[model samples]
Target: MESGVKKLKKGEREFAITAGVFFVGLIIFLLAGWTVLPRLSYAEKVQPVEFRHAFHGEDVGITCDTCHFFYKDGSWAGIPKMEICVDCHVYLLGQSPEEKKFVHEYVLKNRHVKWGLYFRQPECVSFSHSSHVRMAKVACETCHGPQGLSKKPTEYRTNRITKYSFVVYGAEAPSNNYGGLKKEKSVWGTIRMDECADCHRSRGKSTACFLCHK
Candidate 1:
């Protein structure tokens, strides 16, 4: 009977050790996932020009539609071309060094500012800004946040593997309680597939594969 008791105690001790090791391993895995992996997976990029939206919107009284507008045929003009900038930016209106760089480097040289696009979707995905903006009456701030009122440029982080902006995959949304990544209703709203589906469902829109996918 004593021999059997000793054997049982030995088994329990082995189980405890194994449990402890697993707990430690899980902690290490979680820590690396939260911190180290993000640095390795994403590469930060700076836009050619640090354009201030607040200055244009508040100070100069330029609206969002002024730069980003739809054509007569209802096709979305994604970004403002050099022709649009040349009209107002022929000469520096502000004392910003970036404005001087813009006038000298791009405006004078007849080169377009190659702005870093944050909402660059995959080729397979067909997103119609006209349908969303004009037909549905969805505000630009709904998906893009308060970018028009932003004083500073956003930190553009792109995933090296997917070659897409981190916003496409949905960054961690701010929350009061600790939880996994979810849709954000705050400043930087998530644009993931799930969030899109949620939006469609809320609005009673169809989520057919062909509707979004090519």
Candidate 2:
């Protein structure tokens, strides 16, 4: 009976040690999230427009290059001219209201819809899109989310300011919240520099100041 009691005590001690280690790890993870994850920088979606990428990419078989603009260098064509819309919508004029809206309201007037650009680098960064798309054979969705899955007339919102990235190394806030960008007097969304750094890091590449800031 004494031996059995000792065994029970040993098991309890091992469990306590394991539990303590797990608690420590959880605490560290929470700290890292508080420090590393970028909080929303004053984001408000004007209209709840959602797109399902899988349906367009897998089911309908739409090529991304058809809509997005790519450059010859490694830089991205952030926004394409309305002519690109005309090329496709010129035919869909009477077919659907969705198509007609692009052709008549925006394209005909040569006006660009202020689509909130989600994947954006600061004006300082000089990454070329052509080299990556043409030479590297990268797909448009690699950086930008597929839009076909997104609802028509994608509403755009942006921070009135730039948020500091987490790599600011030893910064107080894990992420800098851009108060809001009221540039055009529109709604604001949470796309920030922290997102850019996170996307670059996920690809195992870092676009530090020396590399991209030109």
Candidate 3:
């Protein structure tokens, strides 16, 4: 009877250990789900034209201002027109499938590719590229992330809840935070009104509604 009781207690202890481990694993799984599941709600829109920014920015050394320029009147020339792409892609530059696709669809047809803008702001909001880039000397990568080194075309993902591009919430997000690469959270990294407020607060600038709203 003593031996049987000892064996039963040992089995109970083993069961308790297994249950403890399972609960711990379950807690970690739930936390990970909470952090990552929200991002899956984004509707992914593939770009019609697959242009490599790294090919232009890194390999060819084309700067952001080369295509994205600011007028003297402070108006931002955000996306480059087909004329800019046509300069180099006038003829098939390579035997790659992407090049052929671009040449056949856009260049040959003379139809402008409707490239989706990832960081598009609302009409009511007034954002000055000149104010950020030329005046403040802010790096393009600061807002746009490391597009300069991107080998693939942009994946335009829009959050269903916000109807805004996922890029607006800082392109390299939860991954950056989880990897210990970024100390600040995505809420602070995003280029939303809150992000602007934080920057203004840091710089001692005003956060009046009229300052951003037009």
Candidate 4:
């Protein structure tokens, strides 16, 4: 009778250990599904843009501020107006005939260039441009990556299915990452939460949930 009781307890212990392992594995599988998989939007499909940033940034020596102008303050002067390009044609720097035709037809004719923004702050975010640009005196290249180096205009490719646009970096969606790199000058990258965290932490400011989410 004593031996049988001991044997029953040992079997129960083995069964309990097996159950614990199974439970732990199940929890890990669910966690991965929640964090890693959804990091990418399912709606997004890859779009191909022929323009290469490495060629422009390294070879052409174009500064990022040419397009992304920043004032003396910390606030950024958002997208450039058409007036900036009134004097310059896309063909200014070794542009091909195709570029000339496109520019003459669209930008020259007063049609707006429809470059999609990848890094968009939420409307509710209430970000001030003057503070970050004029007050903070942040560099244009600090947030917006350099673009002046490209010899020709980049081809615009949008994923109709995912509604995401791709540049040299990955999708230019607000939620999309600023490529995996740390600095703006790093090879094509996305903006990630870590970047925001670093900025806020370094400044000793609290980026409250209310400050970011709508």
Candidate 5:
């Protein structure tokens, strides 16, 4: 009987050790998933021309709507074309090396700078900047963060699987408290579909299936 008891205790000891190892392995797996996996899933691409938003907004006193504006027909003129840059950048305004590269490589050569977009939404999704900005009076920084105040261009990171930029998922944006909504941790660093639904629900807006999806 004593030998049987000793065997039972030995089995229990083995089980405890197995469980402890499994628990520690699970924690390591979770940590790697949260940190390492995301970095592996994306590829970074550099912007063609280095544009300083702080210099334009703070130093030159240009507003957000000045470059990104809506046309007379209510359609959004998303990114400014080369013609818009020509107004101020036709000739080298500053002695900065970047300005020289822009004037010589693009402005003088009449080539459009193939700027990388960090916020290119999926084709099925239709986002109206006019409705959000003009009607709702939503600030650009609310969704885009303080990009207008950035001293350097943001590095564009694209997911290999979705071919979509990851900035909307990882970039820091203004808190949900901007539009009288309760602040949420999930809504701060993400612009995913669920977060959009949360924002709409908080604002008493419709979360209908056809609202965002085409």
Candidate 6:
């Protein structure tokens, strides 16, 4: 009986040691996570031109539609061509180095700025900007976030799992109960099919798959 009692104590000590080690390891993992994990998860790329929408929209009073125009055939403009820039930037408008580079390289050469688009829906999806913009009168900020107020170009984050630009998910807030952008300031950061379904259902719009998918 004494030997059995001793073995029981030994087993308990071993178990306690194992539990303590595991707890310590977990704490270490969590501590390292604060700094290390984010770097591992995110990929970064620098944009060629550091464009400021705030300078254009807020300061210059340029509207979103001025640059992202919609066509008569219902397609929304992607990127403004060099000709559009030449209309205003034929001469150096600002003393900024970027403006000078823009005038010298792109404007003078009549070359288009290769702006990288953040939201690139899958080929199966066919989004209509005209229907959303003209008919529904949805503001550009609803989906694109407050990019108009953004002072600097932000580095786009791409989710490794979804393979979609994190901007699509991160840019827009979650749907409010009344079918508009979230006002409570929560960034759930994903525009999934379910989110779209919820928005459509809230607005009493048809949630037909064919409406989104080609």
What TM-score would candidate 6 get against the native?
A: 0.77
Which has the higher TM-score value, candidate number 1 or candidate number 3? Answer: 1
User: Could you give candidate 5's per-residue lDDT for residues 1-214 as a string of tens digits?
Assistant: 7656455467899998999999999999988887778678777676788787878989989987778889987889988999998988889899899899999999999999988877777889998888888988877766675666446554555778877653321123333321212232112232568767887898999999887899
Kindly list the per-residue Cα lDDT of model 2 for residues 1-214, writing each as its tens digit.
Answer: 6656455467899998999999999999887666544244423343222223344456657665665555564455565555765675555435455446656666676776665445566677666667556755666544443344342334443443553221111121122333223232222223345555776687777567665567
Q: Per-residue lDDT for 7-89 in model 1, tens only? A: 54678999989999999999999999887787787776767987877778898888788888888988888888999888898
Q: In model 5, which regions exceed 4 Å deviation?
A: 1-28, 166-190
Write candidate 3's Cα lDDT for 152-193 as tens digits. Answer: 565656667776664322343332122211243232123567
Assess the local accuracy of residue 148 in candidate 2 as a C-alpha lDDT between 0 and 100: 40
Candidate 6 lDDT tens digits, 158-196: 556564544312233342222122243322233557766
lDDT of each: 0.73, 0.50, 0.70, 0.52, 0.72, 0.67
Candidate 4 lDDT for residue 58: 72
Q: Of models 3 and 5, which has the larger lDDT?
A: 5
Of the pair 1 and 2, which is ahead by TM-score?
A: 1
Reference-based lDDT, residue 63, model 3: 77
TM-score of each: 0.79, 0.47, 0.72, 0.49, 0.76, 0.77
Write down the worst ten-residue block by lDDT for model 5.
178-187
| CA shift of 32, model 6, Å | 4.9
In candidate 6, which residue pairs get closer than 3 Å at backbone N, Cα or C atoms, i.e. clash?
none
Q: On a 0 to 1 TM-score scale, where does candidate 5 land against the true structure? A: 0.76
Off by over 4 Å in 2: 1-61, 91-95, 130-142, 145-148, 151-157, 163-208
